[model samples]
Target: MNDMRMSPNLALNQLVAQRRAAGESLVHLGFGESRLPPFAPLMERLAAGATRNAYGPVAGSPEVRAAVAGYFGRRNIPTGADQIVVAPGSKPLLMALGLVVPGDVILPRPAWNTYAPQARLAGKHPIAVAIPEECGGVPDPAALRESITAARVLGRDPRILILTLPDNPTGTLAPPALIRELCAIAEEEGLLIVSDEIYRDVVHDPATEFLSPAEVAPASTVVVTGLSKSLALGGWRIGAARFPHGPWGEWIRSGVVSVASEVWSTLAAPMQSVAEYAFGEPEDIRERLRASARLHGAVAREVHRITIAAGARCRPPTGAFYVYPDFEPVRAELGKYEVTDSPTLARRMLDLGIVVLAGHLLGDEGEALRFKCATSMLYGETVEEQQLALDAPDPLALAHVRSLLERVEEGFMRLVP
Candidate 1:
């Protein structure tokens, strides 16, 4: 079990730090952190509530829960405060969900590494289903049904399906029609759906429609969302989960609450205060989120263009800050330099002073020669610089970020040429 759990991004980060410490000119594209600073008013709200020192309820305070419910309400999901469970981070909340949910975990191949491990940790088997070409999180509906039948034939109980709307490594959004189809299957098979919508707010197109599973299949769906991606508030550690409305929903929710009491106990009072403020539909907060999405969308598009031009195949990112580039087109050139596998490609990129996670780490085939590059790390070093860039008339042309872009473009070119 210990051998099964590993974090490729963390390993890549360590290598990046090592190379930089040795005075290597490293271009870091590893960790996916929002380069923007926290909204000024959000920080002020947290500071004002700094004295909230007591441990709050296991689910969260009523105000915070109500705010989260209202947050989803604005998005057309009819949720209430009772359905909201706030935790330190979506990771733990997801782990708790895994623990409470029964049956084998259904994971899309090439997913965030933790999904499989969380299932294994919760004492369930993780069955991987290959995702369709269009998206990285949810398996193709036909493929999913096939896998479910295959698993059951092999005496496995594949009953829980986890999906990422705007996937992490691939940075692609699952289309609404595909989501509706998957929901239909989940309904037929009696499978629990865990939709990780952490990156939904950072989606590139304002006109792109997103269909939440809760909207499509409210009876057995649990939507997991948090401020880690959208708010650049990872350190704040605020996450929320919305459970369905049914007897089984209460059972699963109770199991998660019980686990929370024994594990994390409760979310921090100050962070809960932050969540209360951020989740409420305030105009200032909405504007801040809008600016952030614009910046992220612009930068991600630029990075995607550079990678594509460098002779790699990458789906144009629709959300999040990732570009999963398959270097198969340049495999001959890569092999000439002894870079034959994904790990070698990752190491070679690091040697060239560009830090990116190997696709193999995210469950892609080792020989695939693919990697996930996080473009968000291109932002400026200082909080003041981040804030200025966030408000700049031309955010994409910010000096520091453009410099990082030049570095990435040069690095990829060097790799293939």
Candidate 2:
């Protein structure tokens, strides 16, 4: 445990906080936290249940489980309350999957920073396959078979394949065809799928065809989601998982619940009340999520435009609020400043008042001149300002938001010019 470092995103957030405390002006793009104000009714729900403080079921209260079950059911993945397990956060649920699921894990080369570390901590190897050029969540389908065979030859047992729909780092959603192809690979390889759909609700376009692995291959997929990304409830730590319905699914859920009982005990009672309210998907909560998604999409596209114009190769963010930009196009220009790799690129940007998570931290190759810039944090510095941005017809045009975008543009331009 001592050998494992703090999660890269969290660590970067802390660094940004420390710098800000020392009075530095920094455009913080290092964290993927949804920088929106909390919904009022959810807060009311939290306060309403504050008095009910006793330990609830380890798997979660029945009401919250059923609510989560309904949440999955509405998404076309039919679920039962027995198939759901609510945890403090999806991180713990993911870790539990790592511990109980047998063998090494297969991950996209540059995945969310936590997957590989969690695999290592769970005493399993993480096999990273490069993602398709179009997205960053799933392994490149052409490479999946060969990578699995290679791992086996090296004495590693690869049993689980984890995917992030509308991925972090590079916030592009995998198209339905891509998802079907990957699910086929998982089926052929006899691999269990852990679909991290935490960002499912944050799709930029309402017409975007978002597909979940559970929908394609429900027999072997476990879908994990939380209120953190969608509802600006990161600190609340409310997450739930929907296991496939079968004997194997039951077995896995039992293992996770046993682990939960020993670790977090249960999702906090007050948070369970909040989860019930949020997952119930009331009209007002739905409206809030929709507004937040619009704000995220607008700001992310603006950042994408800035990165491209400044000579970086980036996927236009289609979901979530992150942009993974590769600076190799400007490698020659960056070389003048000794910025040869992701770390140096991030460091140079930091010196110029922009904060981004280096690609290497998210398990990209150390030599790649790439880093992830989270556009979500560009919304505003205060709750009131964030609300105003959310309510604005053109958020990116607003002065407070535009200044942050300009900072990103200026920082990248300095690297290239």
lDDT of 2 by residue, 1-417 (tens): 543778878888889889999999998888889998889999999999999879988999899999999988888888899999999999999999998889999999899989998999999998999998889898999899999999999999999999998899899999999999999999999999999999999998889988899989988999999999999899999989999899988989999998998889999999999999999999998888889899999999888888999898998899988999898888898899999888899999999999989999988999999999888898888998899999998998899988877887898788777
Per-model TM-score, in order, reads 0.97, 0.98
Which parts of model 2 have CA positions greater than 4 angstroms off?
Answer: none
For model 1, residues 60-169, the per-residue Cα lDDT tens digits are 99999999999999898988898889999899999999888889999887898788778888888888888898878888888899999999999999989999989988
Cα distance off (Å), candidate 2, residue 98: 0.8
Q: How accurate is candidate 2 locally (lDDT)?
A: 0.91
Give the clashing pairs for model 2: none
Clashing pairs in 1: none
Residue 360, model 2: lDDT of 92
